[model samples]
Target: MNFSEMKDQVINGVKWYFNRNWNRDDVMNMDEISDEVHSTLKMNTRIIISMLTAYSFGSSVGFIFNYLFKVEQRFVLRLLVGITIGTGNLLYQAITTKDRREIYTGCLKYCVVIVFSIITFFLLETDTTLRMIVIHSVLILFMGYLVIYSQEILYNADFGDIDYVNCTFNVFFHFPGIMIHATRLYLQGEQQEEN
Candidate 1:
């Protein structure tokens, strides 16, 4: 085909892919809808409690660091907090689901965190401003991940899949605690500066 014709075909293909609706059913039957509701709510309470426990543990650590240690580098503490909570949540999910693949994935994700921690530990001796910049970048990415993760949960719940509700619960639970801790730190700093 000529170049113009090939370009047209590619554009058409892209449009078709994006426009396609994967859910074949125009409307879910009443029985299927009822099943979806039951499945979505089945273990929601347990998931929420587990998530809160993990988040509280993580945030408690961050709080100590911020208030007691006077760590100005809040993002570093935040990362450690996130890793702790994420690891606990992942293991809990794997245990409850009894899924080997999820277990492996969780391990892999933790390995990344471990590597990051090791690197951060070494870099702590470097220039403070540089280290803060790096930590800030990582924190931004992590926050973005949380936002996307929450959206994924909402989408799955709306679509009646509910497969990753545990993951969603953990993200939602962990983030607010961290944010509150950060806000407290800011307020404390302001008070101290005023003094």
Candidate 2:
């Protein structure tokens, strides 16, 4: 083929290749689109890691607090608070429309905890001290999951007009309770396996 005709054919082939591979509109702005996708993914990943770290940390901290702070709640209740955060993180990870890796397991854990938290908080009527601790734990766990970690950060970030607190509160105030809630299930699973 003549040089000009060969060049024209090459151009057409390049365009076709790109068209098949990416949304035509996005193809031209691949960098921008990629940046957006990366940002979202990064946000999601950070929240997940934060949840994991916070739950683990809170469990230990809670155990210590029970002894050191003379906190009104029982040691077990504090531990339960940590488990609640972990479960909420897992559930948010699970139920989130974007990713399903942790969804099912997370949901199961969350539901169990929610039920337990409700019983502990209301049905049991254990004590004033225990009840407050339980309530605080539950509030932090799920609310933290919603506010921090992943979902709320991405969308619906507003938490009932409290001046849109930073992401830190999202995890601290809420997910710890989630970990506490999940701790029970984790124990149950281990017990079942042991049996």
Candidate 3:
């Protein structure tokens, strides 16, 4: 291929990779709505598990920081905890998945979490325990809403049930442990299909 053709192919590939429909709503029929409902339920369960895992992990880290270390600046410590969790999650995902889309989504989620963590931790002047709780809660809530909203947008985009304007916000935001669960689910589905 010539240089111009190669450049066009690269551009098209990038567009196809990012713009691919995840839920496959275009080819879905009414009979598959039941299956979609089941899948949605499973997704919700995974999301809840993700939220709880992140909350518990953050709490444990905060406890360790509080009792073990005598750091005067608790807020900075809490911020460090968030950074550690986000970075660790992103690194783990990058190591495990060869899928570029998954890695990109993971990075996007990490960035959102870290930005929110910084804002919440620095702006709020609360006690150590309360600050930790508030920050974790905020992050969990934000991620949960983003995932659900994105799912809805993707699912309904075909039928025009949702506003197209909101389609620009499509994202797959996973919390600390969520990517592991998602990967497991993907693998399990592949195995079942193969069987």
Candidate 4:
């Protein structure tokens, strides 16, 4: 399937998993919310990362690029982007990794982001800007869907944290969303514990 389909599947999958975890009985518990601090870092991080990956197909990057291109050298802009993305991923891994595999995966993901950012800069011609932007816009929303849904699954998933591959994806795309979902999941967990 195409990128849109893949993005939708990812987003929907996360949502579907979360729906199963929403804990209808504890939807409004206050003390139950503190569990956000103890929630699993894997899926919490993954949902954020994938959203950024999907957002590459969205206009946000292009918009940033366009604005930067106007005032800076293209090469400089690209270098900054690569460093920013890589550094962010590295910091995240350093802070959250549990084992060798996590470190390896984190490095691989940063490499991919840097590579893709370069390729995208070269491949996207000026005339086709609008089309790419529209496509990315849709992907951003799709990624958002995945993020919200995935967090839901954190509370309900039998296996859990299936998408912990990319860290930067979430850093750039979800910002506070990952935290919001974490809060919700923890709150639900708290409620369940009370009962």
Write model 2 residue lDDT over 12-54, tens digit each, in one string.
9765433321122221221222344434644554555455556
| TM-score of model number 1 | 0.29
Measured with C-alpha atoms, the lDDT of residue 28 in candidate 2 is 20
TM-score of 4: 0.29
Error of 1 at 70 (Å): 27
Candidate 4 stretches greater than 4 Å from native? 1-19, 23-33, 42-126, 157-195
lDDT of all the models against the reference? 0.48, 0.47, 0.47, 0.47
By TM-score, is 3 or 4 better? Answer: 4
Q: TM-score, each model?
A: 0.29, 0.34, 0.28, 0.29
In candidate 3, list every pair of residues with a backbone clash.
none
Q: For model 1, where is the 10-residue window of minimal lDDT? A: 22-31
Regions of candidate 2 where Cα sits further than 4 Å from its true position: 1-48, 55-112, 117-125, 128-152, 155-195
The per-prediction CA RMSD against the true structure, in angstroms, equals 16.7, 20.3, 16.4, 13.3
